[model samples]
Target: MTEIYYVEDDGDIGEAVKEYFESRTFKVTLYRTAEAAKESLRKQLPDLVLLDWNLPDEEGSLLCQWIRSRWKELPLMFLTVRNDTKDIVKGFQNGADDYVEKPFELEVLYSRICALLRRAGNPSGQKVISCGTLTINKEKMMVFCDGQEVSVSRLEYQLLLILMEHKGITVTRQSLLELIWDQNGNFVNDNTLTVAMRRLRQKLNQPSCIKTIRSFGYRMEDEI
Candidate 1:
């Protein structure tokens, strides 16, 4: 499902837009404040973001810039009542892919969402994955870091590739097993995964990108 985060201070308007998008079969999460939205970001990165120009806790343009710098591939759209050309330009300059002025028809908003998804190459149910210095060829088991060939073991490549594809989001150990081993329940322990991760990091030589989230699973930083 296409997951989207709607960050707006207006409760009523946010709720209404959330309902409208949910009715159209899109997974939408609404936040009343920038603080709340920022908290949600610690858990997972959504496919798209609907940002208001004026947020209570923080300006939407600031948040958009942060997302843009960290997650270079995620799509951000400004949906606000601010309709001035300056505001629109500011939003785009902050790295918004699309902008919609407020008092907009629901149809127009939906059309804009579709267009962003299409432009992101996600309309065909394909994942938009950028990993490490290299983009993983999911169809072909290949690895290219910094535009150079990097040889890795099969297990190491699979584990690193999965983490890279799900960068900015945490992946549980169970999920990792299913993705790499295609098994539901296994006797694998953290040590095994740690070995694989260490080897993968050694091959890539970028350890800061792969982060350990305390007691939780692993998450690749957005800056990567």
Candidate 2:
């Protein structure tokens, strides 16, 4: 589920692109102004961005610079009517991974997007998984709750990743052990998993978005 933030002022173009992207299995978030996109970026970092020049609220180049400064690995592309050589050059200089002119073919745009993501080594981009106040950044393997970093052991982090990746689903105890310890070549007894889970809960501010299933496994949900 590759998440894309598309900032465009034109209603027609924005909706058309959103529909096309969704049909291709991409989760698209449309922003009519650069300010709106900026605000969303503060909370959720998408895998990529489709920007339009001459945005209603701000210059798209400024937005590109802003995103690049904060998230160097985030893929960015400009889809705009600004086809002049100067504009395209400026776009790349401002941190655009790719750029496409207006009246572009949707298929070609999609291809370019795929290429950008492939170059970044994210063929199947992941959505920024969030549960309640907790956020998981898979690329960095970092977790944050209430805007503060939640430090955890390697095994705990792996456990959190699996649960957050499958939010709302009960992942069984055996599966957790297999995936977290066995698969990682750090085999441990079942009791160790219980201890780690408890420490993780305490460290993440207790009742930290993880719920136990008594005889089953654990699930991540909005309610703690």
Task: List where candidate 2 sits over 4 angstroms from the true fold.
Answer: 123-224
> Candidate 2 lDDT, tens digit per residue, 1-224?
88899999999999999999999999999999998887777655677899999897789999998877756667899999999999999999999999999999989998999899889776224635566666666767877765567888888888888988887799999999888876589887789999989988888888646898999989887652
- Candidate with top TM-score is 1
Measured with C-alpha atoms, the lDDT of residue 12 in candidate 2 is 96
**lDDT by candidate, in order shown:** 0.75, 0.83
lDDT of residue 210 for candidate 1: 78
Expressed as tens digits, the lDDT of each residue in 91-179 for candidate 1 is: 99989999998888888999999899889865212343444344454445666554455788878877877788787799987678777
Model 2 clash tally, residue pairs: 0
Whole-model alpha-carbon lDDT for candidate 1: 0.75
Which segments of candidate 1 are over 4 A away from where they belong?
123-155, 161-195, 201-224
Which TM-score value belongs to model 2? Answer: 0.62
